[model samples]
Structure formats: structure tokens, C-alpha cells
Target: MNTLRSLTLAVSATLLGACTTLAPDYLRPDAPVASAWPGQTEAVAAPVAVADISWRDYFADARLRELIGIALENNRDLRVAALNIEKAQAQYRIQRADQFPSVALSGGQSAQRLPGDLTSSGESTISRQYSTTVGISAWELDFFGRVRSLRDQALETYLATEEARRSAQISLVAEVANAWLTLAADRELRDLARETWQTQQKSVDLTRRSFEAGAVSALDVRQAQSAMERARADAAQYASQVAKDENALAVLTGGQVPARLLPEKLIDAVTALAELPSGIPSEVLVRRPDVLQAERTLRAANANIGAARAAFFPSISLTATAGTASATLDGLFQAGSGTWTFVPQLTLPIFNAGALSASLDVAKVQREIQVAEYEKAIQSAFREVADALAERANLGEQLDARRNLVEASAESYRLSDARYRNGIDSYLVLLDAQRSRYAAEQELIAARLSEAGNRVALYKVMGGGWQ
Candidate 1:
């Protein structure tokens, strides 16, 4: 009873004193980027941060929302990230278990024969021994906080893994949106090509008939045929591209896309996506999951340095057993059969060839490496946001110019065709106008795609999708 009481008191005292670690006091590093985003502008009213907005509200397109939901549930990359979090959680639990004593129960029996020459009574006899024990084995008394530091490291690692999963989710949402938008743009281009082919075929037929009537040169018929074939080839190429885009979306969503949800035109898809607020600040990068993950890793490394420093100090352990033992099974539980043993061990480093110092140095170096990586993550995130903002600043003007070009090209084609019919212009002039109209239409579709893709990029870099 006394030994048990002593063990309990020793553990309590050790725990009371083991509240502090040798690790340096943690301080979050300042963000290594500009305070304001490039080309900042003031807003008349308060604007909401993208991180506060949910993806469901940002993407007004129902089909896009559905696809993102399916990707979150089915994407293999996201599934692996979630599993990593579970694994890390289990590892942390295992490390935490070491902070407390492990108790065990054991029972045993022994029998031996004694010859007459070896017996005090000069007789042959059999001796029996029975015993049972409940004890804690080699439980470390963490007077220097080594075990506590290790526990802290494991907890930080687990938290970092959770942040990694969030980062994956954010990336998955952005990728699906981009793929869906690309498919929409390609479909619009494909449709435009097919329409241009039909129109050129009609011009080719008209030019050939004019040549037969001796009203136009053979060169006119050949030029018209050439334009028709060019449109035909473009139509075929875009069709194949659209199919490839669908396949990519399937890979991202982990299943085939329904026809009803497929987009019809680039403009429709672009308009369906909500506009972002204009008052974003660079400070919002701190909330990004990748940046958070990097900081968590740095914290884990910092904790590891404490464990390394603790290794240089002496360690104490305790092994004690409380039980009953007797020569016979019936006597094992008797009053006099009570037996107890206590063992306390202390280890002090006398000389280890400087291995402990080397270990501590390694830990400090690892922490430094993590600090650099954390800063890099912040810088990369800031650059992504800055680039997206730069692109977005001009896409609206580019879209407007593309629309005007398309309109002017269409009117040019109309005027040239009328002049040709009235014998005031050559077939070559009309062909040039037709080609311009087709090229301008393709450029407009591309410009709309750029505008939409830029919006998605801004939303992602602003840390919006994971919500």
C-alpha cells in the first residue's frame, strides 16, 4: 500500500512540474508580401471577402454547382487527402498515449521437485509457487518534458494534414469550374465553325454558277471553294477538341456528364457566374488553406526542436508491481502472501560523442527550412492573386473590343456581298469580308472564355471555394 501511494505521488509531482518546454516561444511570421494588392482601388461601400462566400452562392449556374458537388464526393485526389487526415489523427493518438503510464495484469505458477539429499528433512518433496501481479512497466516520468514535446509535435502534424485536405478541396472546386467553362467555350466555337461552313458552301455554289454563265472568272470559283474547305476543316478540328474537353471533365468529375447539364454557349456560362467584390485586400491570403498548412508544418517543426533539446537532459522512469505470491495456490490470497516491488530508474548523459548536440542542431535546421517554406507559400499565393487581378483588369475592355470587331466584320461581309451582286465589287473582295467575319466571331468566343476563366481564377486565389 505504501509503495503504491509513493508511485502515485511521484507521478503527480512530475506532471505538475512538466508544464513548460524548451522550445522557443512561437510567433507567427509576418506575411512576406505587399500590404496592398497591386493597383488597389477604394470601394464606396464595404465589400465581403471571398473567403466568407460559399461556392454555391458564387456559382449561379445550377449545373456547375452540381458538377462541383459530384467532384467533391467522387474525386480520387480528394479521397486520398481525407484518408491522409485520418491516418495523421491515428498517429497523433498513438503518440499521445505515451504521455501516461501503461498498466498490465499477469498471473503465473511454478512447480519443482526436491531430491532427498537437497532437502533439509532428508525427504523427497514437490514445491509449488503461485503468483499474480498488477503493475505499470517502464513508465517515463517526464520531468524534462520530452514526452510532452513529442505529443505537441504530433498534434501539430495532424492539424496540418487537416489543412491539406481543405487545400485539396479548394483546388478541386476551381479545376472543375475551369473545365466546365472550357467545354462551354469550345462548344460555342464548334457551332460557329459549322455555321460558317454552311454559309461558305452557299457562296461556293453561287460562284460556280456565275463562272458557268461567263460572268465570273474560274479564280473566283476556286477561291470560294477554298474558303468552304477551310471552314469544313475548322469545324472538324473543333468537334474533336470539344470531345476531348468532355473527356477531361469526366476524369475530373469521376463520371460521365449528363447532356442536360452540358453548356450551349460561352456567353451564357460566363453570365451565369457571379461577379467578385472589388475591395479584396492582400491580408486575405492568410486565410488560404495552403498557407495555413505551411504554418502548421512550421509549428510542428518548432515543437520537434523542444523534443531534441530535452534529449540532452536526464530522463527518469519507474517500474513497479503490486501483487500476491505464495508457495501454494490456496495461500496466494492469504494475508501474509502480499508482495510488492518498486524500481525507479534515472539516466544521465555522461558522454555520447556529441550526438545529442548534433540532434538539436538538426532540429533547429529543420525548423528554419519550414519557416522558409511557409514564407514561400505566402509569396506564391500573393503572386497568384496579383496575376489574376492584372488579367481581370483588362478582360472587360478586350471583350467589348471583340464584340465591336465581330459586328463590323458582319456588316462588311453584308456590304461586300451586296456590291458583288450588283457588279460593283469583285468576288475576291466578298471572300475577304467573309473570312474576316469568321475570324472575328472566333476571337469573340475566345475573349468571353478568357473573361470567365479570369473570374474563376480570382475566386480561387482569394480562397473562396472551400467554403
Candidate 2:
């Protein structure tokens, strides 16, 4: 019995004296971001890389600038994302609160009376008990570092959500801009089709008059009519597409069609070419909110791994309660009436069917997944920039080619019409030339639109136009 008692006392003393924590040490995982393009491509030009410019400077079109402003004000997707950020902020605050002591103010009052039989014993006992406490209740000592790790994880998550919101904003802005540009381009094409149809109508009327005067054959008049009908059909088709684009743009701008933008010869018709700002590529990472958002996600995942590792060891918590309890209200303030209790608890899971191991495994797996996602995002960003850059570089050459074709077609169309009037060529020749001119004009508009579209994409990839 003595031996057993001694052993019991020794174990209890050892447990009481044990103060060292056994939590796992946290380490940040290394994530490498690739710098260069993976595939063969046009050499990226070194430019004066300036960081973070306002959207207004990037897009000089006054109407487009106004549209972006309204979208920013009313975009539903962006608003929802902002609200998510607030929720994340709250969650982070809650998580951080766990690391500090919880102080509370409590007060209570109660009254009790003994039965009538107790009155005969000595004196009837009617007591009123009132208590009030304002003190720190539970404060985790963080000897195991669980609270610290959790707090770090929460902070990372908050930052990640913030980045996510920014990413959403970037995407929304780009979509709205792209849609608006498309609408403009569509309108331009519609105008081209209308002009082409009018030109063909004049030609048809001249051919019919010449045919009645025996200056041209019925076949010539029929060909002219066919060409006019085709032009009218193309114009109608373009108009339909324009309407659809307008509706889509309306939705993107938060469901309000403020006003229809009139078609112009080109995007730069209003804005001077000198005002176009093609900022450098390297500095684009900072300007592009999505890239930063992706990086934050990676950081959040890194912190999560640390949080999970910290869960494997013992947790130490210190709970101290101090209150005044008195036999009588008169003695409540006396030192003898004050009572205090200090409790220190330590919990370590010894065997839990491999639950801790499983959690660690899951966390590690998640980290790996996040790493892959981060790398992929980086690669995608680079590729998008590369595509935009290549397209921008080739745009001048493409425009030159299209312009030459348009000039040649317009001259050939005039020559063929003159020859038909002089009865030197069949109406088929005139029809062919007119068809070529119409196609060239429409294609040229599309090519220019593509150029503008590429810039928008580049802007999106570079991170929302400078800042």
C-alpha cells in the first residue's frame, strides 16, 4: 500500500510540474514563381515599367470612362465580393480574439426564505444574495502555440478574401470594358453594312435603267439586284447582332442601359493615339489585382499548413476565477469573504484512431494543391500577357495588309462599275468587285476591333490598367 501510494504521489507531482509544450514547429513552404515564358514566342520588349495607374488614364474615351464608373458603383458581382470581404474581416477578428484573455462583467441577485418550521429553531431566515464580478475569465496561455497559429491562419484567410474581392473587381471591370467595346465594334460593322447596301442600291438602279435602254443585258440587271439584296441581308444581320451586344452590355453594367454609344470610325477616333499608355510588363504584377489575389491565396494555404501542424500536440489553457462570496451581505467586502480559484488545464490526444495523422495528411495535401493552383495561375497570367503582346505587335502589320486590300478593292470596284456602264465588262465583274470591297471594309473593322480587344485583354492580364 505504501509503495502504491508513493508511486501515485510521484505521478501526480510529475504531471503538476510538467510545463513544456510539445506542439509542432511551423515552417513556411517555398513556392517558386516562374519569371519567363515557357514556350517560344516574340521577345518581350523592355519598357519603362511604371506601377499602378488609374483606370481613367488607361481608357481615355469619356463615354467608356463614365460606363466604368457606373459599373463600379452598381456592379452586383463586385458588391457581393466586397460584402464577402467584410465577413472575412469579422471571422478573422473572432479568431484573433481567442489568443487573448476574455474579460466580462456579470451581476446577479437572488432572494430565498426558509419554511415556517425554521422560524421556531432560532430566527426565520430570509436572505438576499447579490453578486457582481468584473474580471478576466478564460485566458489561454498559448504555451502550445495553438492560438497563435490559429490567429495567423485567420489573418491569412482574411487577406486571401480581400485579394479575392479585388480579383472579382478586376474581372468585372475587364468584362464591362470588353462588352462595351464589342458593342461599339458591332455598331461600326452595322454602319458599314448599311453604307454598302446603299451603294449597291444605286448600282442596281443604274443597271436597271441601262438594261431598259439596251445599254446592259437582263443578266447584268439581275446580278446588280442580287448584290443589293445580299448587302441588305448582311446589314440586317449586323443590326441584329448589335442589339444582342447592347443587351449583354446592359447586363454587365449592372442592368442599366444608360445610353447607346454611337458608332465611330475607330476606337481612337475620339481619343488621341498619343494618350495610349502601354505600361511595362514586369511591374504589371502589382497592378494586376488578380495576380496579387492569387499570391495571397498561396500565402493563406501556407499558413493553413502551419495551423494544422500546431494541432498535433498538447494544448495548455489557464482559467482563473476570482469572486467574492459571503455568508452574510455585511461581510461581502471582507478579505475572508473573497474566494479565488485558478485552474490550468492541458489536453493531449494520445490515441484517436489516426485522426490527427489524417488531418495532417489532409493539410499537406491541401498545401500541395494550392501550390499547383498558384503555379497554374502564374502560368496563365503570363500566357495571357504573351498573347496580348504578340497580337499588339502584329496589329500594325495586319492593319497595313487590310488597308491595302480595302484600297485595292475600292479602286477595282470603281473600275468595274465604269466598265459596265461603257459596256466593256459583264455585270458579274462589278458584282465581284463590290463584294470584295464590302468584305474588306467589314473585315477591317473587325481587325481594328481585335486590336482594341487585345489591349483590353492585356490590360486585364497586367492588372486592371496600371493600378
* Alpha-carbon runs more than 4 Å astray in model 1: 41-46, 113-126, 268-274, 278-282
- List model 1 lDDT by residue over 1-467, tens digit each: 67697767867686877556888888988888876778865422226777878888888788889999999999999999999999999999999999888889999999999999999999999988999998888988887778888999999999999999988998999899889999998999999999999988988898899999999999999999999999999999999999999999898888998888788887544434457764445457888889999999999999999999989888888888989999988998899898888898999998999999999999999999999999999999989988998998898899999999999999999999999999999989999999999999999989988888888888888888887
The TM-score between candidate 2 and the true structure equals 0.85
- Candidate 2 per-residue lDDT, tens place, 141-250, comes to 66555666667667777887777877776777678777877888788888888888898889889878988988778987888888889889988998899889878877
- Ten contiguous residues with the weakest lDDT in model 2: 268-277
Candidate 2 lDDT at 294 equals 60
Q: Which residue runs does candidate 2 get wrong by more than 4 Å? A: 1-51, 110-128, 260-265, 269-287, 327-336
Candidate lDDT scores, in order, read 0.88, 0.69
